[model samples]
Target: MTDLHTHILPFTDDGATDFDDALDMAEMAAENGTEIIAATPHFNIPGIQSRSVSEIKDTFEQMKNKIEKNKIDISFVLGMEIFASPTVGEKLDCGELITLNGTRYPLIEFGFSEKKDFIFSVMDDLISRSYTPILAHPERYDCFISDLQSLYELYQMGVVIQINKGSILGRFGRRVQRTADAILCHRLAAVAASDAHSPITRTPDLSEFVRVLDMNYGDGCSPLLLEENPKRILRNEDVFWESPIPFDYQR
Candidate 1:
């Protein structure tokens, strides 16, 4: 499995505390069947402290070296779960921010209660510039949870709806889990990620994640979400997506 969102790059953000913790997390992910992981730390949130790309990359290299020394059989890629803002485009243009594995597809997130117009605005801005924005954990946001029709519209706009494993399993909350169910039911979510933060809480273990999809959404769904699409993202290839079923909302 290729987990496209994770906070395993230590000392960069609210993820692993140190190199030791990161190694443990990597081992956990590998044992749980995750073969590839993207170290997508949170970046450019309002009023939050941030790290420079060089700093983040230095730590990423350290983690990679440690993984190699320890013989952990997993691959790592550097990225950020960028917070939406007007300056995001400029940052990307100047190389201050990077997409997933340096691909055109950038994994992005927004305020949980942010307005839909703003969500679509940033997404449209990125899309108009020929960048594919992957919305991280849309099920956890009130914007999409309340107006699922708009979520489908995002799908139509060619935005990649990346759902979190926690949301699917109700680890975040009941409301979030319900929203995840709706997204899955309508096939709005094109990709799924661990969004793991540590070895323990919000950990990177994908064992149960594999089981849940196999039991709930069998017949190639598991490989599609956990492997095929993520591999494509890493390779900078066009991802295979399913057409989302529209809601019956009176718009």
Candidate 2:
């Protein structure tokens, strides 16, 4: 399995505190059947400036060397979970931020209570610039959770949806868990990631979620979300997405 979203780079953001912690996260991921992981630290949030692109690359090189030295069998790639901002396109153009694995698909997160119009505007801008924006953990956003129609509209706008495994496992909260299930049942979620922040809490592990998805949604579901789609993102290929069944608010 490939974990598309994770903050395993030490001292980059609110993820691993040090190199040891990052290595531990990688080992845990390898133990849990994850072979590839994208280390996506937070980027461009107000009052929080993560490592620059060059800096992150340097850190990734150091981490890779350590992984090789330690014989940890996990592939690591560089990515950033960019917060939605008006200058996002400019940043991308100027090489201030990076997309997933150097592909056009960028993992984007919006404010928790951002308006639907604002969210759409940002997504539209990114799309207009020929960038595919992957919405990170849409089920956790209040606006989408309250009115799932907004999420469906975003999906229609060419925004790929990624849900957290913890959300599916009800680790975040009950509402997020229900929303994750609803999105999965509706076939709207295109990817599943750990979105893990640390080695202990929110660790990088997808085996349990894979088991649950297979038991409930059939064995095919896990491979599609955990492997095929994420690999597509890494290769900059268009994802094979099913037409989402519109979410029923009455449920």
Candidate 3:
């Protein structure tokens, strides 16, 4: 399996505290059947300025060395959970943004306020520059939870959607869980990720995600979200997806 969203880079943001924490997360990820992970640290959030892409590359290398030293087999890729700001475009233009697996697919986040008007505009700005924006954990967004149709609209506009694994397992609560189920039912989510931060609270494990998906959506559905789609994204290939029919079919 492949994990496309992770906060495993040490000291880059609010993720791992040091190198040891990174190693622990990597080990946990490997045990959970993950072979590749995109180390997406927090970047450009309110009052937080994380490491630049070049610095992230350095951190990734250091983490890779640590993994090798420990004999843990897991591949690391570069990415960032870009907290959307008014200066997002400027940041992307100035090399502050990190794309997942170094492709056009950039993972982005938003504030909790009613920035509905600005959502698509920001996505459009990125799109105009040849970037395909993937809204990170849209199910957790308050605005999206209140207005579920907006998510469908965004998906229709060619924006990829990633649903958090914990949300599906009810780790986030009812609103997020409801939105997550709706997303799965509609085939709105292209990938499922463990937006993991630590070994305990936000551990980098995909096992529960796989279990819940299989139990709820069927055993075959888990691979499409947890494995195949993430693999395709890393290869910079188009995710082969079929919209679920209203008649309760996988299309």
Reference-based lDDT, each prediction: 0.89, 0.90, 0.83
RMSD of each: 1.2, 1.2, 3.2
Question: RMSD of model 1, in Å?
Answer: 1.2
User: Which is superior by TM-score, 1 or 2?
Assistant: 1
6-90: candidate 3 lDDT, tens digit per residue: 8899978878999988888999999989999888888887776566678889888888888999999988888889888767877
List TM-score per model, in order: 0.97, 0.97, 0.93
For 1-251, candidate 1 gives per-residue lDDT tens digits of 99999999999889999999999999999998999999999999999889888998898998899999999999989899999998787789789999998899999999999999999999998998888899999988887878899999988898998998899888988999988988888887778989999998999998887788778877577799889998988898888888678988732
Q: Give the number of the best model, judged by lDDT.
A: 2
The superposed Cα distance between candidate 1 and the true structure at residue 60, in angstroms, equals 0.7
